[model samples]
Structures are given as C-alpha cells and as structure tokens.
Target: MVLILIAMQFYSPTKNISPGNHTQIFIKETNPSPNLKALFETSCYDCHSNNTVYPWYNNIAPISYWIDSHVKDRKKNLNFSVWQNYSLDKKDHLLDEIEKMVVQAEMPLTEYTYLHGNSKITDKEVVEIIAWVKQTRIIYQLGKQPK
Candidate 1:
C-alpha cells in the first residue's frame, strides 16, 4: 500500500500554467481599467486563466486529479484564458452568461474557496464584474455590422 501511494504521486495531472502571451483574454483587447484587471485576477483567474498559480498541495495525488477535473470543466464552460478566440457574438453571449452565473452565486466553485479564501468574490466584486461584462457586451453588439 505504501508503494502504491508513493507511485500515485507520479500520476499528478498536468499543471495549467503557461508562459505564452495572454492572447486568449479577449477583454484585454478592450483595454479594461486597471481596477477591473485586479478584480478579475483576484476573483476569477485561477481556474479561468491559462496561467494558474497552483497551490503547493496541488502536487499531491487524488487531490491534483480532482483539481484538474474542476479546472477542465470550468475552462470548457468559460475559458477566459481563451477569450480572444471567441467571435463578437459569442463574447456577448458569454458575458450574458457570466452575469447570470455571478448573480446566482454559482461561480468560484465552493470547493475552491474552501482552500483559497481569497477566491471568493465579494458582493462588490460581483457587481463590478457584472457591470463590466454588460458594458463590453454592449460594445460588441453595437459593433456588429448589419447583415
């Protein structure tokens, strides 16, 4: 059993960190205010960004797998790290989805906040994020050329 446990350490999932330019974050193109960037980085970047600053314990097994699964699931749902890949229409749609998710307190998955208390989005941060999303979506919508 000890050997099995030791070997399991080698099975840790790939870390999500990256050194590439943040071409994926579409909102960056809009030149978000500095405050907005800070808010997003603090409250949303861990699981949403391409570069995750993994915790030390993330090197452990089982726990690493679980964390990886959550990250993968979230990235599939809304990868802010790959935001630029989305079309304007898609961006607007995603913004709408974000607003709904924030309003309902479904974001920053509970399990995540249990460890990284800072990951929890406060009401003020929620309001700010939603407002920014709405503003950006309006820009995307208005910029759409007539079909």
Candidate 2:
C-alpha cells in the first residue's frame, strides 16, 4: 500500500490554472455587489473557477486526485471563468440552479467547508447569494426575450 501510494504521487492530475483574468468577464457581465463578489471569491471560486488555491494536503497522492476530481466536476457544472461563453438561456438556468442550491444549502459542499472553514457559507450569505441569483436571472431572462 505504501509503495502504491508513493507511485500515485508521480501521476498528479493537471491543475486547473488559467492565465490572465478569467473571472473578469463574469464580474463585468454579472455585476455582483462588492460584498457578493467577496463572498463568491471566498466560498465558490475555488472549484467553480479556472483558478484554484490548492491546500497543503493537495500535494499528497490520491488526495490530490480526489480534490482535482471535485474541482473538475464543479467546473463542468458551472465554471464562472467561462461565464461569458454561456448562452442567455443557459445563464438563466444556471442562476435558477444557484438560487436553489444556496437555499437548500447544497453548495460550498460540506467537505470543502470542513477543510477550509472560511469557505463555509453562512445563512446570511446564502440569503444574499440567492437574492443576487434571482436578480441576475431576471437580466438573463430579459435578454432571452425577443425584441
């Protein structure tokens, strides 16, 4: 088991590091308030964005793979770094999902908060995020409507 573990360390998954300001377009387009932006950077950006601030344990084998898997899955679901690429309809749907996830406390996954306590989303933050998602959804929906 020890040798296997050691071998695993040699094959680390590719890190999700993007060059330049990947979130810039998302920030400008979404126009979230400063507080909301801070909340997002603190709680959601790690897995949901192109850039991830890896924890110390991420250097370990198997654990690195697990963390990388989670990050990939999250980015697959909703990558804020590529937000500007989504269609209006997709944006509206994602906003709806965000609101639902926040209200249900299904985001900032428990495992994430366990390791990074500061990443935990408080009840107040949930309310704020949900409200912002609803407001943002309206904008996306408006854009979807034909002139």
Best model number under lDDT? 2
Model 1: CA > 4 A from native? 1-3, 23-25
- How many Å off is the CA of 16 in candidate 2? 1.0
Over 100-133, each residue of candidate 1 has an lDDT whose tens digit, in order, gives: 9888988766777788887787898778877787
Decoy 2 TM-score against native: 0.95
lDDT tens digits by residue: candidate 2, 1-147: 999999999989998888888799888988889988888888898999999989889999999999999999899999999898899989889889888887888888888888888888888888888788888888888887899
Report how far off residue 76 is in candidate 1 (Å).
Answer: 1.0
Superposed on all Cα atoms, the candidates' RMSDs to the truth, in angstroms, are 2.0, 1.1
Model 2: ten consecutive residues of lowest lDDT: 125-134
lDDT of 2 at 62: 94
- Model 2 has an lDDT value of 0.88
lDDT against true structure, model 1:
0.78
Every candidate's lDDT: 0.78, 0.88
Model 2 residue runs over 4 Å out of place are: none
TM-score of each: 0.87, 0.95
Give candidate 1's root-mean-square deviation (CA, Å): 2.0
